[model samples]
Target: EVAVLANQTTFFGESGGQQGDAGVIKTENGAIIEITDTQKKLGALHVHLGKVTEGDVKVGDAAEFRVDHARRSSLRANHSATHLLHAVLRKHLGDHVTQKGSLVAADRLRFDISHPKAVTAEEAAVIEADVNSLIRENSEVTTRLMTPDEAIELGAMALFGEKYGDEVRVVSMGEPVANEHAYSLELCGGTHVKRTGDIGMFKIVSEGAVSSGVRRIEALTGADAANYMSARENVLATVAADLKAVPEDVPARVKALQEERRRLEREVSDLRKKLATAGSGATSGGDAFKEVNGVKLALRSLDGIPAKELKGMVDELREQMGSGIVALVSGDGGKASIVVGLTEDLKDKYSAVDLVRIGVEKLGGKGGGGRPDMAQGGGSDPSQADAALAAIEAHIAG
Candidate 1:
């Protein structure tokens, strides 16, 4: 980094939450130095920081200093908008609101204030409207140099913990308020627009908590605000077209579609439950059941049934079997799920958890958990689902 000190300059140093000016300085010998930032040193001098892009610049050389006018203009608008925002917030959120911190840049402005709770959307809208109203009024912005005491006596707000000299610069904007003072008045040294109208427009982009008792609000002004609104309108238009409705009717259309989707889901779930409970008879000439050691055992493998519905299916199958052990396995997308249940009379002789664990281990799963009468488990391998059920049958037979 390079620092250039001049006897006199036009660049504004970084201070008061506003970024410094950035530009170039050209020497008489054509040496170019691109200044990326300007800051204060020892509380007085302006230090221009950058790298020498061209020929070397020596001491006592005459150079032309230039500040980027476009960037400076953007900064001015954003800084001025912060003042208006501060005043409007205090008006709507009570007098306890004071600026805690801030960041004023070319693209946006963030103002941190002492607020205990989140600023509601309704309150933010009102604050934004009040600021824009004042901008539309095109009030003149005035600055005066006076003693700090005199400025305070005139109702100008000073930032806490900021060191101010005997002489301070006071900025005021908008029409007079109930206190017979300007609507917004503060001790500020940052650059700003000549009139409120120069801000063009104001739009609040976000508001959230920054700290325990502080909230931060970010906003845009002028061309940036216009562009932000334009992008949002385009998004709204696209969504409306996709929904086959006008922009004004999009919300209602979406709500109706959501209700219809939920209703269809309920109907589909009921149909699935009915299909799983069908053909549950143990001795209806099907190979679903066998007498192992005088204990009737029913083992069936199902398809496309979700694991969550397995417990209910097991309950229905156990009731139909009358007095036997029932084990069911359902496979979907290469995953295996197993549920084991026993009749109340047989639960004391055989544990459902032990049977399910035996089946789960065969399917590459670790353990199974539930009450002794009923248990559920799953595994990653579905191709071994039949083998897993066969293993359970062998265990019951022993």
Candidate 2:
């Protein structure tokens, strides 16, 4: 642990929803200690965390400290962009816009604000355009130390739930308006870019409702934003090529393809139903029967037949067979579904549920319960379908 005095250190601690600065400290003995994180305690002391990988690092040893410039630059870019985004939101959404929460990372930033509804796509586009306009203007960023009352008098915004001392740090961006105040002036302690143009660019990647009356905007800046836009362009180009259409016509092409798919689906379903009735003597499937105790036992397995059409098939078969029992099983792979239908005469003697339960058991499956006239059950193993059908016949025979 290395203690960092206020003005003696250049690293900024983790605060204001922003990550801490990371760097390394080179000791007198040529040993290097990596400082992966910096944090400020309640007592205003900065603590640096890392381990000495080389020679021993003793306390009170003078060391050369350095902060990772690239990482700090990215964080500073995103942090300053967050302030501009807040201002843009307030300008478009309403004066009621207040910061609910925020997270400033090197790759992206998330800003939560008070809003009654989700930001529409049009509103988001306008807000993003407004922010990029400020970036293009290259507005100046100013920081000053002033009393809290004085900062508030200048219309500086203070975050809710934040504890501020009598003396607070005020950060402002953009030129002074008629009120002699910058467009965005907030009582913040986080590090920021020297000018709005230093942010390079700003883009809102997503917007959504986080909670009741609260909305969140996730955005990226600088190289991160550039990379995001490049990736999206590549995806759109690929999709357009696949659709054989220009980027502007891709949506219409996709809609046409979907309509074609639905048409093909309906045609295939009708053809399948027609083919099923060809030799089956019914829409469900072809039925064969065996005589058992003066009752006709009709059974057939309708492979690939939908469950919805199974009942109609059984009913038609019962009408043709007239005085027997109908048992149908259908499905694919290792799954099976069985339906049983009883003739008016057999309904009084043998139960359809009992026959279905006995059939499912042979297939190592479950489910069978209904009136004596009709019942349905399913099995996990389709390999035993033949044996299950035989079991159904034997159950009725006994």
**Every candidate's lDDT:** 0.90, 0.83
Residue-by-residue lDDT tens digits, candidate 1, 1-398: 58999999899999999999999999999999999999988988999999999998999999999999988999999999999999999999999999999999999999999999999999999999999999998999999999999999999999999999979999999999976989999999999999999999999999999889999999999999999999999999999999989999999999999999999978876776666556443232355456788887777777777888788877876787788888888887778999999999987899999999999998889898898999989998877777887888888878
- What would the per-residue lDDT of candidate 2 be over residues 5-55, giving only the tens digit for each residue? 434578888998999888887878888878888888774777777777678
- Error at 217, model 2, angstroms: 2.8
- In candidate 2 the C-alpha lDDT for residue 222 amounts to 95
Q: For model 1, name the residue pairs that clash.
A: none
**TM-scores of all models?**
0.82, 0.79
Q: Judged by TM-score, which candidate is best?
A: 1
lDDT of 1: 0.90
